[model samples]
Target: MVMTNFLQKRKSVRDFKNKEIARDSIEAIKNYIEEIEKETETVSFKFYENGSIIYNGLKGKAGYSGVMIEAPSYIALMKKDEEKESCLNTGYYLEKLNTQIVNLDLDSCWITLDNVDDETKKNLFGAEGTKVDYVVAFGYGVGKKLFTPETTSGRYTMDQIVFKDEIGNEISADELETTGLLDIFASVRFAPSHKNSQPWRFVMEDHNVVLYMEKSDEDSRSLVDMGVVMFYFEEMAKTIGRYGKWSVILEDQDKYLKVAKFSM
Candidate 1:
């Protein structure tokens, strides 16, 4: 499952059953993190609440009942200080780990700086230069009310934000449906961004997918935001069972680029 399908399946799992996480799932998650770390060399994992409250702090709303007792357990993703684009790398790599969790049939929701507990954060991650850019909460659902009309309505559509070319050149919602790119691109629309900036763009050069970072976009953590978007496209390809590899490409234009062209 890709992150969007997982996102479609994902709900704010507020009420959770008191079930313990399976050992195999735990190992799988750890192993997945290890694999990513080996490849990207920036991801680190930490557990909280035994898988119940993965992230807490959304403006001091640490939902977990126990400091360590609230949820089953939580995983905190951190980027190493040495990595050049650590934050962006963290987002991209973590989403890959996240999607796999969904493929395993688990549920989770991403959290920003506001929803986590600062007290334990320093211990879970580091207090200095090592920043915990993003957090995700995962666990078994308790059959609780997932979303309100306001929440679902808030999700931005392709037309509302995405463009056929650039930010101003808006593409019609109806037109997007008929295009073959929708299934893959629509998933990018759902990929999480810091403060919902949606700081990503795609340039299709024949069979290549050129990723561009608009001027305002700052890859504070290396291409972490771009990584999140890449994760969406990767998962979408897999949903259709499409196989491909990604790489960094450069364009001789005014804008900064983080290209990940796919090949069949």
Candidate 2:
């Protein structure tokens, strides 16, 4: 399947069959990770066949009750710096991996490591400087289910999340339709976030799109969530031949924190 279609079909799977992934599929995943790491050079990933070590340690953590789905394998994400940019890069890289996993006919769910125990961290990373950011549990799902955009989880509408040239001025669907950005904005609207907070805002500035995170929603994980949304936007844009890149914008500080700018 094409990248855009595969991305649209992707959904969070919390259940999986007790089956190991094919060696070729695992190799493909490793190669893809290596490729992305070389491009970003800001994150590292480690795959573990045994999920029990991380799963058992997550027991009794808030918001994880009955939500921690067991799988045949898990991929641990790590980074050296604990700064904001590092967290955002972590999310960006993992979402790229998730897209590749979906294309391989595998399913995954993003697992938080905020409350992960020290021993579990040691067992997963086995290093000191690099900090664990998140984990993705992936494998072949137990049952087949057809998915569509409507079947996915609820999300904020484009108008609620996107703006026209400035914050508080929400972009209308008509404007997006006229500007040919509806599809790209739709992908950002559906990007995953912690508790589905959807704490991102975009300003359509000429040929560029400016990304911002709500000041109140600012946190380590939210920065990562912004990166996820940014990745979705960029990927969707690429499908339509709009090639651009992200650069941090640090001059603004107020209601919304300027995270990055997409220069087209």
Candidate 3:
């Protein structure tokens, strides 16, 4: 499958077969990781089996069942370097690579603050000055459809998640289609947030999509979330054959409010 096709087909998978991923598949993952690592200097990855020490930390931890229990293979996404928005960049670029993994017919789930074997992760990656923001569990799921939580878990619609100019001024789904903005925003709506907080808002003007942080906090971690959403927008745009460029526009001394516009 093509990368964009993979992005469209990919969803979080928690149920998996007990069998290990194929050696060729593992090699494929490693090669892809190497290529991405070269482009994005901050990120690296390590793979492990389900029973290995890497996956043992959360064995007895509460609320770790569901998809996490059955991930026969694990990919530990690691990043190094500080200063600037490093963790956010880690999530952004690593997820782009994960999208490619979907094209390979594998399953993945992003682990943020839950079901993580911290010590084992650190040992495997060997912590530097950097922090392990999160990990993604990957493998071949058991059945065709693994029942994504989006159905029962609930998700925000385009109107609720995105705005045209202000928080109260919602961009209706119908209006979005008329404006041809739905394709990009659709992907942003599906991008994962911290515990599904979805603390992002969009201001669509002309062809530019300006990202603004709306939550109570704009700390380092939030920048990581920003990076995640940025990746989603770029990938979604490319998937739909609308290519755009992104850059961080420093607006204030605080460095919280960011502007990432799209240009034809």
How many residue-pair clashes does candidate 1 contain?
A: 29
Off by over 4 Å in 2: 2-8, 50-63, 143-154, 170-174, 250-252
lDDT of each: 0.60, 0.76, 0.63
Name the lDDT of candidate 3: 0.63
Per-residue lDDT of candidate 2, residues 105-201 (tens digit): 8988887766666765675568541377578989987654434566566777777778888877866788777767787777666677777778898
What local lDDT score does residue 91 receive in model 3, on the 0 to 100 scale? 65
112-202 in candidate 1: lDDT tens per residue? 4434555556655657313565566676766654543345545566665455544446666575555456666765665556555666776
- Comparing 1 with 3 on lDDT, the higher-scoring candidate is 3
Better of 1 and 3 by TM-score: 3
Q: What TM-score, over all chains together, does every model reach?
A: 0.70, 0.87, 0.77
Clashing pairs for model 2 are: none
Model 3 clash pairs are 14-67, 88-224
Among these predictions, the greatest TM-score belongs to 2
Off by over 4 Å in 1: 1-4, 48-69, 82-84, 113-120, 125-130, 143-150, 154-179, 214-223, 239-242, 249-264
Q: What does the lDDT read for residue 48 in candidate 3? A: 66
